[model samples]
Target: MVPRRIICCTDFSYNSEPARELAVDYAKAFGARLTLVHVIDSSLFPTYVDWLGDEIDQILARTKEAAETKLQEIANKCGDLSDIKTCCEIGSPAEKIVGVANDEAADLIVVGTHGHTGVKHLVMGSIARSVLRTAHRPVLIVEASPLG
Candidate 1:
Protein backbone atom coordinates (compact mmCIF):
# COMPACT_ATOMS: atom_id res chain seq x y z
CA MET A 1 0.00 0.00 0.00
CA VAL A 2 1.14 3.54 -0.68
CA PRO A 3 2.24 5.46 2.40
CA ARG A 4 -0.30 8.12 3.31
CA ARG A 5 -0.86 10.56 6.12
CA ILE A 6 -1.10 9.21 9.67
CA ILE A 7 -2.57 11.08 12.65
CA CYS A 8 -1.33 10.24 16.14
CA CYS A 9 -3.25 11.59 19.11
CA THR A 10 -1.51 11.77 22.45
CA ASP A 11 -2.45 12.97 25.92
CA PHE A 12 1.18 13.07 27.19
CA SER A 13 0.49 10.30 29.63
CA TYR A 14 3.14 7.66 30.25
CA ASN A 15 0.88 5.17 28.53
CA SER A 16 0.47 7.39 25.49
CA GLU A 17 4.21 7.60 24.90
CA PRO A 18 4.26 4.05 23.58
CA ALA A 19 1.56 4.96 21.10
CA ARG A 20 3.64 7.88 19.92
CA GLU A 21 6.60 5.56 19.41
CA LEU A 22 4.54 3.09 17.47
CA ALA A 23 3.14 5.87 15.32
CA VAL A 24 6.65 7.05 14.56
CA ASP A 25 7.81 3.57 13.66
CA TYR A 26 4.87 3.02 11.39
CA ALA A 27 5.43 6.37 9.77
CA LYS A 28 9.11 5.53 9.24
CA ALA A 29 8.33 2.12 7.79
CA PHE A 30 5.70 3.40 5.42
CA GLY A 31 7.38 6.70 4.67
CA ALA A 32 4.12 8.41 5.58
CA ARG A 33 3.58 11.95 6.71
CA LEU A 34 3.06 11.79 10.47
CA THR A 35 0.93 14.34 12.27
CA LEU A 36 1.25 14.38 16.03
CA VAL A 37 -1.74 15.96 17.75
CA HIS A 38 -2.46 16.80 21.38
CA VAL A 39 -5.85 18.00 22.52
CA ILE A 40 -6.45 20.08 25.62
CA ASP A 41 -9.78 19.17 27.10
CA SER A 42 -11.97 22.29 27.19
CA SER A 43 -13.68 21.07 30.30
CA LEU A 44 -10.44 21.58 32.16
CA PHE A 45 -10.32 25.30 31.45
CA PRO A 46 -13.55 26.20 33.20
CA THR A 47 -12.57 24.23 36.27
CA TYR A 48 -9.35 26.21 36.48
CA VAL A 49 -11.20 29.48 35.90
CA ASP A 50 -13.37 28.87 38.95
CA TRP A 51 -10.38 28.14 41.14
CA LEU A 52 -7.79 30.53 39.76
CA GLY A 53 -10.14 33.57 39.40
CA ASP A 54 -8.27 36.53 37.89
CA GLU A 55 -5.28 34.32 37.15
CA ILE A 56 -7.28 32.26 34.64
CA ASP A 57 -5.51 33.84 31.71
CA GLN A 58 -2.15 33.12 33.22
CA ILE A 59 -3.18 29.57 33.92
CA LEU A 60 -4.40 29.02 30.39
CA ALA A 61 -1.28 30.61 29.01
CA ARG A 62 0.89 28.38 31.09
CA THR A 63 -1.13 25.37 30.09
CA LYS A 64 -0.72 26.13 26.43
CA GLU A 65 2.96 26.83 26.90
CA ALA A 66 3.52 23.56 28.66
CA ALA A 67 1.55 21.68 26.03
CA GLU A 68 3.62 23.27 23.29
CA THR A 69 6.80 22.35 25.10
CA LYS A 70 5.71 18.74 25.48
CA LEU A 71 4.61 18.57 21.87
CA GLN A 72 7.99 19.82 20.78
CA GLU A 73 9.66 17.24 22.99
CA ILE A 74 7.70 14.48 21.32
CA ALA A 75 8.54 15.88 17.89
CA ASN A 76 12.21 16.10 18.81
CA LYS A 77 12.26 12.54 20.08
CA CYS A 78 10.78 11.39 16.77
CA GLY A 79 13.96 12.70 15.16
CA ASP A 80 14.43 14.50 11.86
CA LEU A 81 11.62 13.39 9.63
CA SER A 82 10.63 15.78 6.90
CA ASP A 83 7.22 14.19 6.78
CA ILE A 84 6.40 14.85 10.42
CA LYS A 85 4.01 17.59 11.56
CA THR A 86 2.97 18.47 15.11
CA CYS A 87 -0.18 20.21 16.33
CA CYS A 88 -1.83 21.18 19.62
CA GLU A 89 -5.56 21.79 19.73
CA ILE A 90 -8.18 22.64 22.34
CA GLY A 91 -11.56 20.93 22.75
CA SER A 92 -12.80 17.43 23.44
CA PRO A 93 -9.99 14.97 22.92
CA ALA A 94 -11.86 12.45 20.82
CA GLU A 95 -13.64 15.08 18.74
CA LYS A 96 -10.51 17.09 18.10
CA ILE A 97 -8.54 14.02 17.13
CA VAL A 98 -11.17 12.81 14.74
CA GLY A 99 -11.65 16.30 13.40
CA VAL A 100 -7.97 16.69 12.70
CA ALA A 101 -7.82 13.31 11.01
CA ASN A 102 -10.68 14.34 8.79
CA ASP A 103 -9.34 17.80 8.17
CA GLU A 104 -5.89 16.51 7.33
CA ALA A 105 -7.23 13.74 5.14
CA ALA A 106 -5.40 11.17 7.21
CA ASP A 107 -5.32 7.60 6.00
CA LEU A 108 -5.21 6.25 9.52
CA ILE A 109 -5.84 7.46 13.06
CA VAL A 110 -3.31 6.14 15.58
CA VAL A 111 -3.95 6.45 19.31
CA GLY A 112 -3.06 4.85 22.63
CA THR A 113 -5.39 2.69 24.67
CA HIS A 114 -4.99 2.72 28.44
CA GLY A 115 -6.94 -0.53 28.65
CA HIS A 116 -9.54 0.92 30.96
CA THR A 117 -12.08 -1.71 31.90
CA GLY A 118 -15.37 -1.91 33.77
CA VAL A 119 -16.24 1.12 35.90
CA LYS A 120 -13.01 2.87 35.12
CA HIS A 121 -13.81 2.64 31.44
CA LEU A 122 -17.27 3.98 32.14
CA VAL A 123 -15.99 6.88 34.18
CA MET A 124 -12.86 7.94 32.33
CA GLY A 125 -14.14 6.90 28.93
CA SER A 126 -11.79 5.99 26.10
CA ILE A 127 -10.68 8.42 23.44
CA ALA A 128 -9.34 5.52 21.41
CA ARG A 129 -12.67 3.80 21.49
CA SER A 130 -14.50 6.94 20.42
CA VAL A 131 -12.11 7.55 17.56
CA LEU A 132 -12.35 3.93 16.48
CA ARG A 133 -16.09 4.26 16.33
CA THR A 134 -16.28 7.64 14.62
CA ALA A 135 -13.30 8.02 12.31
CA HIS A 136 -13.84 7.65 8.59
CA ARG A 137 -10.33 6.40 8.07
CA PRO A 138 -8.74 3.27 9.41
CA VAL A 139 -7.83 3.40 13.10
CA LEU A 140 -4.81 1.93 14.78
CA ILE A 141 -5.36 1.43 18.51
CA VAL A 142 -2.09 0.78 20.28
CA GLU A 143 -2.11 -0.74 23.72
CA ALA A 144 -0.19 1.09 26.43
CA SER A 145 2.27 -1.80 26.81
CA PRO A 146 5.11 -3.22 24.66
CA LEU A 147 5.70 0.25 23.11
CA GLY A 148 5.27 -1.21 19.64
Candidate 2:
Protein backbone atom coordinates (compact mmCIF):
# COMPACT_ATOMS: atom_id res chain seq x y z
CA MET A 1 0.00 0.00 0.00
CA VAL A 2 1.19 3.56 -0.66
CA PRO A 3 2.18 5.58 2.34
CA ARG A 4 -0.63 7.68 3.75
CA ARG A 5 1.65 9.71 6.01
CA ILE A 6 5.27 10.64 5.36
CA ILE A 7 7.95 12.14 7.61
CA CYS A 8 10.63 13.96 5.62
CA CYS A 9 13.78 14.86 7.50
CA THR A 10 15.76 17.86 6.32
CA ASP A 11 18.96 19.56 7.41
CA PHE A 12 18.31 22.45 5.02
CA SER A 13 21.51 21.56 3.20
CA TYR A 14 21.71 21.98 -0.57
CA ASN A 15 22.24 18.25 -1.13
CA SER A 16 19.17 17.46 0.95
CA GLU A 17 16.82 19.29 -1.39
CA PRO A 18 16.71 16.28 -3.70
CA ALA A 19 15.46 14.10 -0.86
CA ARG A 20 12.89 16.72 0.09
CA GLU A 21 11.78 16.86 -3.51
CA LEU A 22 11.45 13.11 -3.57
CA ALA A 23 9.34 13.30 -0.44
CA VAL A 24 7.14 15.98 -1.95
CA ASP A 25 6.63 13.83 -5.02
CA TYR A 26 5.65 10.80 -2.96
CA ALA A 27 3.28 12.85 -0.84
CA LYS A 28 1.60 14.32 -3.88
CA ALA A 29 1.40 11.00 -5.65
CA PHE A 30 -0.15 9.13 -2.76
CA GLY A 31 -2.25 12.03 -1.46
CA ALA A 32 -0.31 11.66 1.78
CA ARG A 33 0.32 14.10 4.61
CA LEU A 34 3.85 15.49 4.97
CA THR A 35 5.83 16.48 8.01
CA LEU A 36 9.14 18.27 7.40
CA VAL A 37 11.37 17.98 10.43
CA HIS A 38 14.65 19.82 11.06
CA VAL A 39 16.68 18.94 14.08
CA ILE A 40 19.19 21.37 15.59
CA ASP A 41 22.14 19.24 16.52
CA SER A 42 22.93 19.70 20.23
CA SER A 43 26.41 18.26 19.83
CA LEU A 44 27.63 21.74 19.08
CA PHE A 45 27.44 22.61 22.75
CA PRO A 46 30.80 22.61 24.47
CA THR A 47 30.99 19.45 26.58
CA TYR A 48 34.29 19.93 28.36
CA VAL A 49 34.27 23.67 28.83
CA ASP A 50 31.70 24.36 31.53
CA TRP A 51 32.79 27.99 31.75
CA LEU A 52 31.16 28.82 28.43
CA GLY A 53 27.72 28.34 30.12
CA ASP A 54 25.63 31.35 29.13
CA GLU A 55 27.41 31.76 25.81
CA ILE A 56 26.69 28.16 24.97
CA ASP A 57 23.04 28.64 25.94
CA GLN A 58 22.78 31.66 23.65
CA ILE A 59 24.30 29.73 20.76
CA LEU A 60 21.83 26.89 21.24
CA ALA A 61 18.91 29.34 21.38
CA ARG A 62 19.92 31.13 18.20
CA THR A 63 20.57 27.89 16.36
CA LYS A 64 17.11 26.58 17.17
CA GLU A 65 15.51 29.84 16.03
CA ALA A 66 17.37 29.69 12.74
CA ALA A 67 16.35 26.09 12.30
CA GLU A 68 12.67 27.01 12.66
CA THR A 69 12.99 29.69 10.01
CA LYS A 70 14.80 27.36 7.64
CA LEU A 71 12.30 24.59 8.27
CA GLN A 72 9.48 26.96 7.31
CA GLU A 73 11.27 27.83 4.09
CA ILE A 74 11.75 24.16 3.31
CA ALA A 75 8.08 23.48 4.01
CA ASN A 76 7.14 26.29 1.65
CA LYS A 77 9.37 24.73 -1.00
CA CYS A 78 7.40 21.54 -0.61
CA GLY A 79 4.94 23.60 -2.73
CA ASP A 80 1.15 23.84 -2.71
CA LEU A 81 0.50 20.22 -3.51
CA SER A 82 -0.17 18.57 -0.16
CA ASP A 83 -0.70 19.17 3.53
CA ILE A 84 2.76 19.96 4.94
CA LYS A 85 3.69 20.47 8.57
CA THR A 86 7.03 21.88 9.72
CA CYS A 87 8.75 20.84 12.94
CA CYS A 88 12.02 21.91 14.58
CA GLU A 89 13.54 20.07 17.51
CA ILE A 90 16.75 20.31 19.54
CA GLY A 91 18.44 16.92 19.93
CA SER A 92 20.33 14.22 18.10
CA PRO A 93 19.24 13.97 14.47
CA ALA A 94 18.55 10.27 14.29
CA GLU A 95 16.74 10.12 17.61
CA LYS A 96 14.53 13.08 16.75
CA ILE A 97 13.77 11.78 13.27
CA VAL A 98 12.69 8.41 14.57
CA GLY A 99 10.68 10.01 17.38
CA VAL A 100 8.84 12.36 15.03
CA ALA A 101 8.14 9.60 12.51
CA ASN A 102 6.60 7.42 15.20
CA ASP A 103 4.76 10.29 16.88
CA GLU A 104 3.22 11.37 13.61
CA ALA A 105 2.33 7.74 12.85
CA ALA A 106 4.14 8.04 9.56
CA ASP A 107 3.98 5.23 7.04
CA LEU A 108 7.35 6.22 5.57
CA ILE A 109 10.47 8.19 6.44
CA VAL A 110 12.53 10.09 3.86
CA VAL A 111 16.12 11.20 4.37
CA GLY A 112 19.26 12.16 2.42
CA THR A 113 22.57 10.38 2.71
CA HIS A 114 26.02 11.84 1.97
CA GLY A 115 27.07 8.55 0.29
CA HIS A 116 30.23 8.39 2.36
CA THR A 117 31.96 5.02 2.36
CA GLY A 118 34.70 3.06 4.21
CA VAL A 119 36.85 5.18 6.57
CA LYS A 120 34.78 8.30 6.03
CA HIS A 121 31.64 6.43 6.97
CA LEU A 122 33.23 5.14 10.14
CA VAL A 123 34.65 8.52 11.14
CA MET A 124 31.28 10.25 10.69
CA GLY A 125 28.54 7.70 11.20
CA SER A 126 25.57 8.08 8.93
CA ILE A 127 22.33 9.43 10.40
CA ALA A 128 20.27 7.68 7.72
CA ARG A 129 21.81 4.38 8.73
CA SER A 130 20.92 4.93 12.37
CA VAL A 131 17.39 5.97 11.49
CA LEU A 132 16.98 2.99 9.21
CA ARG A 133 17.88 0.62 12.01
CA THR A 134 15.87 2.44 14.68
CA ALA A 135 12.75 3.53 12.84
CA HIS A 136 9.65 1.38 12.93
CA ARG A 137 8.58 2.37 9.42
CA PRO A 138 10.22 2.20 6.02
CA VAL A 139 12.81 4.85 5.08
CA LEU A 140 13.63 6.27 1.63
CA ILE A 141 17.21 7.51 1.12
CA VAL A 142 17.99 9.86 -1.73
CA GLU A 143 21.46 10.35 -3.13
CA ALA A 144 22.69 12.80 -5.72
CA SER A 145 23.46 11.60 -9.24
CA PRO A 146 27.19 11.15 -9.94
CA LEU A 147 26.90 12.87 -13.29
CA GLY A 148 27.00 16.23 -11.56
Q: Could you estimate the TM-score for every candidate?
A: 0.86, 0.91
Reference-based TM-score, model 2: 0.91
State the C-alpha lDDT per candidate. Answer: 0.83, 0.84
Task: List model 2 lDDT by residue over 14-101, tens digit each.
Answer: 6677888899999999999999999887886676788887887788888888888888877876777658898889889999999999
Give the per-residue lDDT digits (tens) of candidate 1, residues 1-148: 5548999988888878877888888888888999999998877777644767768677667887899898888888897676888888878888999999989999988898877779877644477878888897899887775342
- Candidate 2 has an lDDT of 0.84
Model 2: lDDT of residue 13: 72
Give the worst 10-residue stretch by lDDT in candidate 1: 45-54
Model 1 pairs whose backbones collide: none
- In candidate 2 the C-alpha lDDT for residue 59 amounts to 85
Q: Candidate 2's error at 123, in angstroms?
A: 4.5
- The positional error of residue 122 in candidate 2, measured at the CA in angstroms, is 2.8
Q: Give the TM-score of candidate 1.
A: 0.86
Best by TM-score: 2
Off by over 4 Å in 1: 47-57, 146-148
Instruction: Tell me how far the alpha carbon of residue 2 in candidate 1 is from the true structure, in angstroms, after superposition.
Output: 3.8
